[model samples]
Target: MRLSQSLIPTIKEVPSEAQIASHRLMLRAGLVRQTSAGIYAWLPAGLRLLNNIADIVREEQDAAGAQEVLMPTIQPATLWQESGRYEDYGKEMLRIKDRHERDMLYGPTNEEMITDLYRQSVKSYKELPQVAYQIQWKFRDEVRPRFGVMRGREFYMKDAYSFDIDYEGAFVTYRRMMLAYMRTFQRLGVKAIPMVADTGPIGGDLSHEFIILAPTGESQVFYDAAFEDVDYGAANFDSAKPDDLGRFFGIMTDNYAATEEKHDLDVWGKIDDSRKREGRGIEIGHIFYFGTKYSKAMNFAVTGPDGQKLFPEMGSYGIGVSRMAGALIEASHDEAGIIWPDSVAPFKAAILNLKQGDPTTDALCEDLYGKLRKVALYDDRSERAGVKFADADLMGHPWQIIIGPRGAANGLVELKRRATGEREELSLDAALAKIGLNAS
Candidate 1:
């Protein structure tokens, strides 16, 4: 993309309302603009990052055997009433009335709606183990929405529902989801620890919150230090048998980890000093096994092998797709701006024509831009060299390739890595070799 005609409206000073580094950087980098108290309009640059994160989430969900589907943002309140949560779910629920005076709501979650959908069509154990997921906007109407997208009232989410005939089957499905979440975070260049968590309004007996340690995070967490080094990707889950799933579950559960709401002082004291670690963490994803909570309430039943009708055991998994943008910035930013992970950076590299008007520099940048269409951003703006360099850093592309008259004359250009702040002078061919077609 060429910055000369792009819609990135970057600013020089931080907004007073932004309280954290990620929030400030997001504003200054022109990634998003606030539409209301907690609602935002994602600009071109931010939307690119959002789509990348959603792609990762979809890939992981598909690998775990979940099929993707789209659900409506506005749902009839009758479903919530059927689940006996219409009165239970408090003010956060954005209740409304339609022309016929029927109760309607902007869904905060989709348990009730998904249960109603399943009950209407699925009638037997033949479809016993099915998982459906959707990526859509959700609203909670937070009383004090703040911290940008991190705690926004309106945000995007990836929510999946799993249905099984019995408790044992449901547990296996839950384990698959847990492993998938771990791998998803790892691929996004973040280490997220799974900690036992309170389900809150989403009632359930079993729940786990995937959290990443950050000093400015809202949740306090305690865990074994060994969790920091565990590699979920290396675990052989793809070819594992049913029994192997049980073993993997046991190995992960044997470790100690919990959020402050579920933390136990006795368990913390039992661990050796070297193994104990406490820190603040941001909650990025959550999974829960709610047995027949939604199915029974909404009359979602399937016939068992013995010819008896039974409510299907069910579970839900959620990832805050929009909130992850803020979480990533919180975990990986420096004084200059966000240090985006290469996997999710909007552009792999920014090709800055330091002397834009110079014929040699222009020709070199244009050539490089044409050759690397998929992974390059050509900065052809008529801005000062210093301004262009600062904007490139603030935008957080993984690399910056600078071309100037002097460098072009000498058959050399500069390549700089955003994360490490390392630079190298190399020939045009060598520079392209260093950052291949799919470098990001």
Candidate 2:
């Protein structure tokens, strides 16, 4: 991606409406633009990264044995009515009337719709443990939407549902989804703690909210230091097996963690002072085991082993995909700008031609850019070195390859690591190898 040829509208002045660092940086960096209250139009650069985040979510879900099926943003109102939540969902539900005067809505969540889909197809205990997921747009119609995408009305989300034969089956499915959430967050370049949470309108007795530490977070959380060192990738638990899931779930339940909404000082006091971690965190994902809540309300049932119809136990898990763009900024940014993690960065590195049009400099940058084009954003714009440097830092590419007439003539390039303010002058091939461009 060449900066001069691309639509990344990096700007100098911050927008007046942006209330938080993430919001300000997003606007100034030209990642997104507010079209209406809490509604944004994701720009090219932002859209790419947003899709990357969704891809990671999809991979984790698939690895955890969940199958992906896209659900529509708009759904029939009857689905909500069938689950007895039509009136209970409140104004956040974007209820609308179609041209035929039928009640419809931009779905806030898909519990009822998914239940309808499930009951219409599956009819026996033989297909009892199916998990379906979707990554799509959702609308909540927040009355006071603020903080950019953080509290947006229309946003991207990944919601997954599990249908199982009974409570025990549902619990195992829930644990698998929870494990997926933990791995997803870790890969998204943030450490998140699973804290006990209120299910609210979702109506679940067992729930966990994955909260990421950020100074600007809305909710306060407390957790044991044990969460800091868990090797999620090394868990080696199979999602399909109940015993494996039960063991994993037990490990999570044994951890001391709770959000302010469900905090307990009695239990909190028991943890060693050195191991107690108290801080504010952003809710990045949530998982819940809501046994038969929707299935029973919607009168859905599958044939049991004994030939009787029984409501399947179920659960729902959610991750805020669009909000994560803002959340990632909140959790990882420094004074300069975004400092994106490699796994979700729009481009792995930015190749800055410090002296654009200089024969030697331009040639060196062009060669390097060609070699790294698949994972690099080439800054070929005719801007000052300072302007290019500032914009590169602001956009937060993991690395910046600085090329100038002096360095180009010497057959060397400056490699700058964005996360740490580390720079090294190295031979062109050495620089390429250091940035993983020519690594064997």
Candidate 3:
């Protein structure tokens, strides 16, 4: 994408309303524009990042055997009523009335709706152990919506529902989702610690809120340093076997990881000082294991193997898909701007034509851009070197390939890694090799 004609309306100064690094950088980088108190319009760069995050979230969920299904943003209020949470959900639920005077709402979460879908179809125990998820937009009118997308009224979410025949099945599903969450965050390039958390509106005794450590996080957290070395990509935990899943779940819960709300100093004291790790953390995702909570209230029943009617155990897992883009910045940014991890960066690299009009620089940039247009963000604007360099850093492409008249003529260009601030002067071929551009 060419910045000369892109919609990335980057600003020189930070907005006063942005309280955190993520919100401030998001505004200055022109990733998103606020339309209202808690509503935002994701610009080109922001949308690309959002989609990238969503794609990875989808991949991990699928890998964990969760089938994808797109759900609607608008839901009928009757579903909530059937679950006895119509009035209990409070004003955060955007209650509405259509022209026909039927009660409805913009769903904050899909627990009730997904449960309703399950009950309508799939009878008998044979359909048990089904997990379905959706990557969709959700809304909850926050009383004080601040901190940009992290606490927004409207946001994208990956909410999945699991239906099982019994508590044992639901527990296994919970761990499967847990494994999926860990891998997802691992790929997203953040060390998200799973902490015991309150289920809140979702309503479940077994719940965990995955929190990523950040200097400017909302809540203080205490965790074990052992969590740092556990590799999700390696060491497979077979979710199919009860014993394997049980062991995985045990390790996660046994670790001394908790937020201020659930912290126990007695438990914290037992851990060795060397193993104790403490920091502020931002909640990235959540998983729950609520057995028969919705199925019982909504009268969702299926026939058991013994021909007896039984309520299917259910659980809900959620990831704040839109909030993740903001969280990534919070977890990984410097004084200049966001330091996007390559796996989720909007663009792979930014090709800077330092002297745009110079024939040598122009030709070199054009050739590089043509070779990498699919993954490169080309800065071809007629701007000063300072302005272009600053904007490139603010956007935080994983790499910046600088081409000047002198360097272009010599078949050499400068390469800078955004995360490490490492710069190398090398031939164009060497620069391409560093960014893994072997073709063309």
Candidate 4:
């Protein structure tokens, strides 16, 4: 993609309304544009990043045996009413009436609706241990919508619901989802620690919130440094095995990790001084095991193997697909702009034609761009080198290939890594190789 022909409208001045680094950088870097007080339109680069995150979440969920399904954004009020939460759900829900005066709502969560769907299809224990998930837009009319996408009125999310025949099955599903969440965050290049959390509105006695560390986070958190040593990617745990999941759960719970609200000083003092770690953290995902809550409320039942009717145990897992963009920037950005991790970066690298009109520079940049066009951005605009550099940094591509007259003439290209302000002049092949590219 050529910047001259692209839609990345990076701004020189930060918007006054942005309160956090992520919010400010998102707008200045042309990731999103606010169409309303708390609603936004994701531009090209922003949407690409969002899709990348969603893809990883989908992959991990699939690996955990969760089937992907698309659910409606607008849900009937009857579902909430059946669950006895319609009037008590508070004002954040956007309730509406359709042509025939039927009460409807833009769903904030799909607990009731998913339960209804599950009851309609599965009539026996043969379909036990089912998990369904969807990645879709959700809305909650926040009283004071602020902080860009972080606390927006409308956002994208991945919400999964699990149904099991009994408590034991539900617990296994919960642990499986837990492992899936850890793996998902790990693949996204973020260190998300799971902590015991209150189950608000979700109505479950057992709950955990996955929080990622960031200096500008909403809450102070205390955790054990041992969490840092657990390599989730290479862990030997198997989701299908109960013993493995039990061990995984034990490892997670053995560590003392809690947000400020739940922090216990008595417990904190018992840990080894060197193992203590404290930092601010942002909540990126949550998991809850609310056994039979929805099934009992909605009269959802299936025949057991012993020919007895039973209400299926249930759980719900959620990850804020859109909020992650803000949380990621909050964790990884610097004063200049966002330093995107390679897994979720919109573009892998940028090709900068420092001397756009110079024949040698232009030729070298064009050749590199042609080779890496799918994963790169070519800055071919008639702009000064300083302007190109500033925009490149603000856009935060993982690598930048600088083509100048001097470097191009000598068959050399300057490669710079965005995370660290490190640059090296190398032969074209070596530069591409260092950037993890091939001569395909």
CA lDDT, every prediction? Answer: 0.89, 0.89, 0.90, 0.92
Best by lDDT: 4
Candidate 4 per-residue lDDT over residues 118-228, each given as its tens digit: 888999999888999999999999999999999999999999999999898998788889888998999998999999999998897999999999999999999998788
Q: Write the per-residue lDDT of candidate 2 for residues 283-338, one digit (tens) a residue.
A: 88888899998999999999999999999999999999999999999998988898
lDDT, model 1: 0.89
Stretches of candidate 2 above 4 Å error? 237-248
Model 3 TM-score (2 dp):
0.97
**Model 3, span 187-289: residue lDDT tens:** 9999989988888989979999999988888999999987886777752554445575555566677778999988999989999999999899999899888
Each model's TM-score? 0.96, 0.97, 0.97, 0.98
Residue pairs whose backbone atoms clash in candidate 2:
none
Cα lDDT for residue 16, candidate 2: 89
C-alpha RMSD of candidate 3: 1.4
Q: Which has the higher lDDT value, candidate number 2 or candidate number 4?
A: 4
lDDT of 1 by residue, 321-388 (tens): 99999999999888788899988998888999999789888888888888786767789998999999
Model 2 weakest 10-residue run by lDDT: 233-242
